[model samples]
Target chain A: MEQIIDKYRGDSTAMIAILHDLNAAFRYLPREALEIVSDRLSVPLSYLYSAATFYRSFDLEPCGEHEIQVCLGTACHVRGSERILDALSRRLGIKPGETTADGKFTLKRVNCLGACALGPLVSIDQKHHGHLTIHQAERLLEAYKDEHD
Target chain B: MMIEVKINGKPAEVPAGTTILAAARSCGVNIPTLCHHEALEPFGACRLCLVAIDDAGRQSIVAACNYPLEHSGLVVETGTSAVWQARKMSLKLLLARCPGVKVLQDLAREWAVDTKDLLLTEDRGEECILCGRCVRVCREVIGKSAISFAFRGVERRVSAPFDQEPDACLGCTACAFVCPTGAVKVIEQNGRRLIAPWHSNLEQVACKECGRAVAPLKMLAHLRGLAGEENEQAGEGVFCSRCRRLKTAAAVTALPEVKFPGPFMIP
Candidate 1:
């Protein structure tokens, strides 16, 4: 954490970048870590929390080992991405934005991935899997689950 | 430099960069506003102060609080039908969101806005019209970015850090003092002050002279820090405003008198 703050030279303007680094390191912003950032940067905790919550990328809670983000953007929605998301949710036994009880997979509904051509897109562990059907998505989840086993 | 503008057919001269709202008010023209406060910057959140501006024949509707007068001889119509319709729509929307807020209700009554046709959502029984007054006051005036608007769109709300008790709140109640809808509630009881909206409960400091609750100890300390080291002794004693004034008066009266020459007589 000190290294992250040191990386930004504790500049207050690099707050978002610092938070991004912290998120990448810890997968979510821990309260203690945020407090350290606040103290080191001389920025208020409320302001940090506000920024953390405002951005869709930052996670406040501990995320799962595998993150599955389903695009719900205009093009993806028209191509029936909600059905894929619903299938994934049912199979994972967790709603969108929730991690599985085993902490293996976190299902997230994202607005866009900026790859509109790849309608009904899903990304797993930062790897985009586009033009998917429900069966293929479930199979992909099963593969990740098998890897966990 | 002063600029001349006509508001509702009445000529008014105001300083350059003065907002249409301020200029109209100086000339005895009333433009209704909700989110505007004299001390803070214009937020234009409520859209209640909408007015029609005819700038050299180009017509535009603007919120008067933040719209500065950039040019002279601009014609502003505060009571035009278009302005009235815009204000009425804004009121209707505000009423739908905060059905129980008396200020909105009164405005609706005066504007003859009928709530019968409003597409009502599930009433959250909320009075906070999201005017951003409390949030702005705490950030801009108090200089403690202790609380802020979190989330976006329908989920947006003024909240402390993680919705927990704000660690940096001074318990000054400045947020409550500036809130138009009485949404930010501050209650003092059992030697503690509770700022309800932010879930901040702070121990109140008692005055040294009369033992009255002065303010939150943290707030006094913050003020003392702001006052600097030279005024440390002055800031050490926790005295309410009334007691401080009385003490100053007593100190002034106890000063030694000195003889001086008579005014206009050198002898």
Candidate 2:
């Protein structure tokens, strides 16, 4: 936390950059880091949380080891992304904002990853899997699970 | 300098930089607003106050709350057919968002927006309209910013940082007072004051006169600090604002009446 704050020289304007670094380091914004930044930057923790929640980039909860992003943008929505999301939710037994109990996978829905050409896309740890059907999505999840085991 | 603007075809002069809502208000032209509060900055979030503005030949529908009356001879239409149509749709969406809210219901009744056919799911139990009043007041007025709007679009909500209890919160009930929907509930339980939705709890201060919980300790301390007084360990509990006001009035009334010399007195 100190190193992250030091990199930004504790300047208030670098809040977003600092949060991004903290999120990247811890996979989410830790409470301890937020408190430290609040004290160091003279900004209230409330303000930090506001910034975190206002922007879609930050997460407050502990993310799973593997991040799964399902795109629900307009193009993807029309292409049956909801079915893919439903399948994933059923298989994982967790909704869009929840992580697996084993901490193996975290499922999330994004507006768009700018891959509209390949609609109904899902990204596993930032690896794009485009034009996915429910069956294909289940297979991909199994592959990841088998790889993990 | 005053800016001459026509609201509903009635010419009115107002100070420059006044918003169309305020301008309409000056000329007694009522423009309904949900997100606009007098104490907080105007947030053009709720489109209930949308009005058609004609600047010379060009015209566009704009949020009356934030649009400034910078230029003179601006034609503002507050209750035009087009404006009412836009406002009706906005009211309908708001009605759907906060299904059972009586305030929205009242607005719907006035606007003739039918909520029977509107799309609604099982009650989400969320009453906040995301007007941003409580958020702005907490930040700008209280300077504590204990709560803020999180997430985007439909998932937007007011909560403490990270949905955790905010340590900096004074539990002043400013959010509860400013909330138009009464979503933020402040509960006093067993010497502890709790602010719901934000999940902030603070020590309660007892009123000196009635022994009732008056305010949170931190809020009292902040107010005392603002009054430029050092923290003194006073043994007696202080009277609440109501009690203090009553005591002052009693003391004033109990004062001896001294009549001034009259110019002429009847024998």
Candidate 3:
């Protein structure tokens, strides 16, 4: 953390990159890392948390090895994404923002992925699955489960 | 030199860079606004202050709070039918997001907006309007970035660090006072001051005379420092404003000159 803050010369404007690097390294922002950043950059902890919460990409909690993001954009909403999300939640036995008990998957709902043309999209580990239904979503989950099993 | 602009078919002269809303208000034209405040910088988040502007034959609708009167020969319209429709639509959307807010409901009623089938999420309670006023005041005025708007869109909220208790909060209640929605709350109980929604528990400073909690400890120290009062003097025991006034009155009356009836005191 000191090395990262020094690399940015402790500039507060590079907060986003600093947070991204921390997130990349830890898979989520830890409180200790945020405190170090705040102290090193002389930025308020509240501001750091605010920036972290403002962006959707930043996560404050531990996520599963395979992160699942369901698109809840306008297009997806119109194409029955809620039912797909409900199905995913039921199959994983965890709602959005919750990780599965086995630590295999974490379900999250995102606003938009900018792929509105392909309505009802899901992304697992940065892999986009577009034009999906509840059955297909469950199958995709099964595939991941089988791969891990 | 003042710039002359026509607002609502009336010519008005205002200083350069004055916002259209200010100019309209100067001309006694009332324009409804939700997010704009006189103390903070202009944040054109709310679309309720939208106005139609015609500059050099090109017309556009812009938020009047941030629109500057920098140009001459500009025609501004505040009460057009199109403006009314846009405001109504914006209010309807806000009504959908926050059906529990009385101010929003009043605005909706004024605009004759039907509140039928609004997308009110039962999980979301009546809370901050995300106008950024509390956050701005906390950071800009108080110099305490103790709270801010966390998350984005529907997930946006005013919170402290990770929504936990804020360490840098001075318990000034600036956020609560500046908040438009009355979402931020400050309550003192059992010698502890709590700023709700953020849940910042601050230590209270007990008044010297009455033993009542007068203010937050940090707030008292900060204000005393700002006023050039020494910490030792404050530590000696501070009185609340009311108690201080009463003590001063008692001391003045107890003065030797007052009892002896000096020449000035004698009728």
Report the C-alpha lDDT of model 1 over A1-149, residue by residue, as the tens digit: 99999999999999999999999899999999989999999998988998998887789999999899999999999999999999999999999999988888889999899999998999998899999999999999999889879
Q: Can you tell me which runs of candidate 1 are displaced by over 4 Å? A: B1-4, B208-211, B229-267
The C-alpha TM-scores of every prediction are 0.88, 0.87, 0.84
Candidate 1 on B1-267: residue-level lDDT in tens? 988999999888899999999999998999999999999999999999999999999999999999999879899999989999999999988888888889988888888987888655557778888889988888899988899988877888899989999988989998989999989999998779999989999988888998888788788778777877443453357788999999999999999987776667745
Sort the predicted structures by lDDT, highest score first.
1, 2, 3
Window of ten residues with lowest summed lDDT in model 2 chain A: A49-58
Question: What lDDT score belongs to each candidate, Candidate 1 first?
Answer: 0.90, 0.87, 0.86
**Least accurate 10 contiguous residues by lDDT in model 1 chain B:** B227-236
**RMSD per prediction, one decimal?**
4.0, 3.2, 4.0
lDDT of candidate 3 over B1-267, digit per residue (tens): 788999988899999999999999999998999888899888987799998999999999999999889978999999899998888888877766677888998888788876665754452676667888888898889998998778776677778888789888988898888877788888989998998888889878788899888888788778888999875554347788899999999999887863544566635
For model 1, which pairs clash? none
Candidate 3's TM-score: 0.84
For residue B187, give model 2's deviation from the true position in Å. 3.5
Which structure among the candidates has the greatest lDDT? 1
